[model samples]
Target: MTFTDDLKKENEDIFQMIFDHPFVQGIGKGELPKEAVEHYIKADFEFLNAFIQVYSLALSKSVNREDMAYFHEQIQFTLYDEVKPHLNFSEYIGVRFEDLQGHPLPPSGDHYIKHMLYHANMGTLAETLGALLPCPWTYLEIGQKLINKYQPTKEHPFYKWMHFYAESGKETEEMRKRLDVLAANSPVDEQNRIKDAFRKSCQLELAFWEMSLTCETWSGELAVIK
Candidate 1:
């Protein structure tokens, strides 16, 4: 199978797992009690804040200039423009990246974000953008699934929160055209470097979600203390 094919398969696997998982299903469909939904949202946001900040710093320190530029653009466009501006739910909780300064990322998190940044700076641009493909693509799939399952209207914060999934410019076919230009100009070695980066980045995302599943399991065994 092609690399993109494998990524789509991986995404399908995760979507199935999350969809079937009782906790996620409950939250997605608004079947979970209000308290449980609030609790899960807190945990999810905590992890995400830690994630984006470390990713930002890691990419900021990347060895390659152009890849670093990609990371910066991702931060500027996706995080600032699409995510932060669109998601009012994030603001209500005050769970921004700044809230997670000095927090230690899981080994999986470190490897995923840093590797992408490193590859972008040093590897091929297809690979650089490829490293980014997982976020928007996976998000797009899940957001569509959720909206199909439960129609979150404009009045609902859930609707606004899911905008990040559909709004990323990278998820468009236009990105492929842009990447094709780089692929033509790039050396063979650089091209392979990008392909490797893209593959590994997808694997990292799979692992991160797996970790979240584990976290959910462990947290569930604990007492619910409000």
Candidate 2:
């Protein structure tokens, strides 16, 4: 099996937990509250903004033309295409995507971005992919699972959201293939770090869904601090 396949096999338990989460289940069933869905739009907007920043930083760090091009493509896709579903969803719900910009992510959302930025700032390109790959992988997996269970049509409330993720993206495929190649070429020690990073990212992806579903935010002094 490929390296990504191995990572998924080992992370299967986390994947199951994510699938079992009420937030994910509700999305699949189209039973989520608009408040919850709106919360997701705002958080994800902030999340992907951070994503573009990471890719921009990565692009700067790339030593080779190929790597630079890869990062550039990722940035473009994220800005223009990856966010399309969010925009579409917001419109369907009468929320302006522009209005959601600059909204602060809940703690877990910030933590997830900080996790990736830590790798992006401190690690090699291959190590950084470990942190980045799971975002797409987990979302694609969630989409596929929901599609299989619900067989959602265009009439589905979240058909666009579900279809967008379920269909995955070129960047997702590129990330997996690039990581596999990097893993094949890297030493054993680096491979372990990659595995650890991938696992942590998967766990964070699960947390993000829960955060969105519950509209979780800081409370008391912590809430006031922001």
**Leading candidate by lDDT:** 2
Which consecutive 10 residues in model 1 have the weakest lDDT in total? 216-225
- Candidate 1 clashes between residue pairs 3 or more apart in a chain or in different chains: 64-121, 67-120
Q: What tens-digit string does per-residue lDDT give for candidate 2 at 9-117? A: 9999999999899988887887876777777888898899888888887788888999999898888888888777886667666777777677788988999999999
- The residue pairs in collision within model 2 are none
- Candidate with the greatest TM-score versus the true structure: 2
TM-scores, one per candidate: 0.59, 0.92
lDDT for each residue of candidate 1 in 49-166, tens digit (9 for 90 to 100): 5445544754655678865775566556544555452234434444553442343444455566677666556654466666666556655656667777777677654566555555
Compared to the true structure, candidate 2 yields what TM-score? 0.92
